[model samples]
Target: MFSTVYDVIVVGGGHAGAEAAAASANLGAKTLLITMNLQNIAQMSCNPAMGGIAKGQIVREIDALGGYSAIVTDKTAIQFKMLNKSKGPAMWSPRAQSDRMRFSETWRNMLEQTDNLDFYQEMVTGLLFEDDIIIGVKTALGIEIKSKTVIITAGTFLNGLIHIGNKTFGGGRAGESAATGITEDLVKKGFESGRMKTGTPPRVDSRSLDFSKMIEQPGDVNPEKFSYLKTTTALKEQRSCYMSYTSLDVHNLLREGFDRSPMFNGRIKSVGPRYCPSIEDKIDRFASKERHQIFVEPEGWNTIEIYVNGFSTSLPEDVQDKALRKVAGFENVKFLRYGYAIEYDYFPPTQLTKTLETKLITNLYFAGQINGTTGYEEAAAQGLIAGINAALKVQNKAPFVLKRNEAYIGVLIDDLIIKGTEEPYRMFTSRAEYRTLLRQDNADLRLTPMAYKLGLASKERMDRVVEKQEKTDLFVKFLKETSVKPEEINPILEANNSARISQSMKLFKIAARPQLNFNDIQKINSVASFITENNLDNEVIEQTEIHVKYAGYIEKEKNQADKLNRLENVPIPANFNYEKVKSLSIEARQKLTKIQPETISQASRISGVSPSDVSVLLVYMGR
Candidate 1:
């Protein structure tokens, strides 16, 4: 083997690249990670937060699979909140406000410490392809490094262009140079590519704000960390965020810059995230609304810097200052950095397989922003799955595929590989049908054994998981076997706003009521004693509660997933000419032929492929 030939070579050390390199290296692959700037590895380019909604579940899933995102976030996190606490377990997500500087440093430190991982700070300008297969990368300095497999997680850096008002620049990020060569080369290779844009809100000095003028948003009383690793958080001491809103005055000032706005003036033809729109888009879309929420998030414990969320703008800096001043507490705010919009190149993910490997290039894979995803957590989850599959590929092992029923990661990949997003894809709870079985609290329960079998999860982690499962099983049995008399459980039932117990009932039966919870049962001294005697960890206790309470729904979703799985299992041969089937729509035939979906279920979900088209496909497949 050549001196520099590595088992895996990962380019662009952003969130996705960092996780991918770490996972591949941790799985015993001799991996080399290359990036333009090592100092910015894992930087929070947009927000100083780790997760939100379905994104948090992705972070937890990455952790369960032995990826480093959750571990780093937990270490540098300043404020932690479990979002959607009032909702069902399926809806619960753990998010953390992170120290931007510390988060990057933590990732650097972790990468430095990991075995079999090497780092190089340089820009990759091209890939070396021989006989239609990617053999390695060519750096800007004209260095050719060979590797068995290459994972590209370039984030928003590939052919990146920034737009601020009417001004435009060629840079990956603020003060950073954009990567060249790769996009032109890929396009020449017949890869279909498109432009997508995403924007970040400005950062302001927190010292200039008057706290009394804004509403304080506090962290969860008992903030939970993301990793299953035993790490203690300083519970009593927590940071507080403030909430403000954009007033009509602010909107009016922002409108003055509309004529010069890149998004409105047609400078940016790329589609931006619909859920996270620029201030100008909001004003134009919701013209009558008096105000929109603005979250004033702290950058770190020691820094006066704060991220102005929900106030993303691509207006001129002077215009941004004028509008921001109109917000109640930010009247005297000083800008630390101006917000701008970035446009980057991304291959529609349908160009890749469910394993994230490129369909055109053998042993070459893509992950993170390269696949048009938006958030750090989403990128990290993709990185982990990609890394695992890459390592398995090297070992000649069976491909590791997570079903949509098993994880949000699975759903995410399936969606990307099947539907191919035009805009930056983000995670949402509503996207997962089997969400009840994919709760954040039970990520380790759902994935640890698989990780252990893949040799990614540590034996110690597996042992702890097994112990937790045993305890959870025992506790679930207790709930099923133990019964309470009507006199014993009625008061507790009434307190939780549930129907009064009519007679003796099994603990599982009462806990299954939507209003009643296992915590209510725990409050009962007798039941509390039974739980304490089992010596269960809090995670197990929580998981067991969710399992018992949502057993019926979980089972139903599982069955639904199983029914879908039959179609998922029915493989459609690649290169099957949809045009041969005369009954299919011309549009359907073209889309089906282009996407070349591997299964009937996947073909059904693609845009423009209707129910009738799917039926035609099914008959053609002899299903």
Candidate 2:
């Protein structure tokens, strides 16, 4: 192990690192996964949940690409809910609250079972470089191992500084030690470094709190799984999460600790997630709001630990306790762990290419928090792409990059590399311009073929994709061709409060009505007969409905995406000189020069670049 060279060495065993190792190894690369503590592999460092809103789509996409996040989540999920179900299919996202310990254990078992992969327990101290390219990694014990590529998914470990009240300590997580040497080494090597902070809420003893005082939020009546694979099944039994609210009194109790709060007292300067603000931040930002809802979530199926969601704080321990006592259902709460904030070092993702390989260092990559992204889904997506690209580079194959229209993964990376987040970047459905075309339900149909071609997805997965596509198309055809009598369809239309049909109509037309959903229209005798005769599954039915109901919107989005794709597909020469474009704006030239965008479309997305700059580039390219 000491003398042999590996194809890819993945540092950090968080979501990103684990996925990177798995993807690299599964692609036939001799991969090695190194972590400070092997037992904590793929730990749910923050919330004990996977997939929410756009995040759920990301997990499904990972599974479609033959990664393991969805499978693990589904297997260990205690609670499952499809978020935004009231909205369109594009907004419907599947989420799962997992058994925290079992989630990590499941990930470890999966990694252990992956062939061509090795595990090592050590803290990486620095990189072994061949000039500008990283050749391997150096461990804390001074042992060096050679590798063709190194992916650092260090997460919140690099120079981690935790805060509680005015007191700060060196810890990546609550108890784990902060990593050293690597951040300093990279800075010395001329990488631009920045700081970002993220925090977790206190985990209290569930038995100590009165759930009757809070609202019971149960899982969906018919809970769904995240993975497209049939191997993982839906939850047969479920767990319920309780909801409580923080009042003006709770806010007043919290404000008393403001003097000691690291966030408010200027003890912590780095930015946290804008979308997921802490309790203090929320209170301070929205002073007039009477209350903020708090969700009390169980940590596992058999545990007293309860995560106090929506109450993330870095105030004194007593302050956290005092504030929670003021809340309705927590008059006598016992904390298992106090809430605290941690600041860590991150490299601006603009330093990375579309494939996540560093522009300055060949074969070297960064994923997860190191790339300034928050959430397990974002990190795992980056890791999966980095791992795949690293392995492809080693195997002398073309790098795989997803377009923004193709997947949410594409929107994330494109945003990171182009916009370059100063704060922690998170994914949202609104971030995707073509979200309707990138719905969570159709990820397999969009991505499995590509993954299969890359040798990442299995033949079974490909077969599933083909069957889904063929059946969905056939069902849609049947709906369009078959006609239903007015008497048969009128009752169903009346049930939905829609005007009765005067005569016979095609089932497709009836299904497309704004008021009539799949459930409403499926009651028709002909539709039910067709479903029973074809033996179509729920997935095929859902796909066919989405295709039929949102056909115009979907087609509109596709046309828009195809139009923009022309500019996206325009290639910029690798050695293209921005210095020659003197007619471009000063800020545009400077940003373009530094970013070195690969296409005219990418150039337009840069902050300083305007339409005029893009026009100049288009003119120069003789388009």
Question: Among these predicted structures, which one has the highest TM-score?
Answer: 2
Candidate 2 residue-wise lDDT at 577: 80
TM, every model? 0.97, 0.99
Q: What is candidate 2's CA lDDT for residue 599?
A: 91
Q: Write the per-residue lDDT of candidate 1 for residues 114-232, one digit (tens) a residue.
A: 99998888999999898678889998778899988999999999899999998999988888999989888778878888899999989999989997999999998888898887753
Off by over 4 Å in 1: 231-236
For each of the candidates, give the backbone clash count.
0, 0
Collision pairs in model 1:
none
State in Å the error of residue 21, model 2. 0.6
lDDT of 2 by residue, 1-623 (tens): 48889999999999999999999999999999999999999999889999998999999999999999999999899999999989999999989999999999999999999999999999999899989989999999999999999999999999999999989999999899999999998988899999999999999999899999999999999998999998999999999999999999899989999999999878899999998888999999999999999999898999899988899989899989999998988998999999999999999999999999999889999999999999999999999999999999999999999999999999999999999999999999999999999999999999999999999999999999999999999999999999989988888788779989898888888888889888877787778888899889999999998999899999999999888899998888985888888999999988988888999889889998999989999999989
Worst 10 residues of 2 by lDDT: 518-527
lDDT of 2 at 122: 94
lDDT of 2 at 33: 97
Worst 10 residues of 1 by lDDT: 229-238
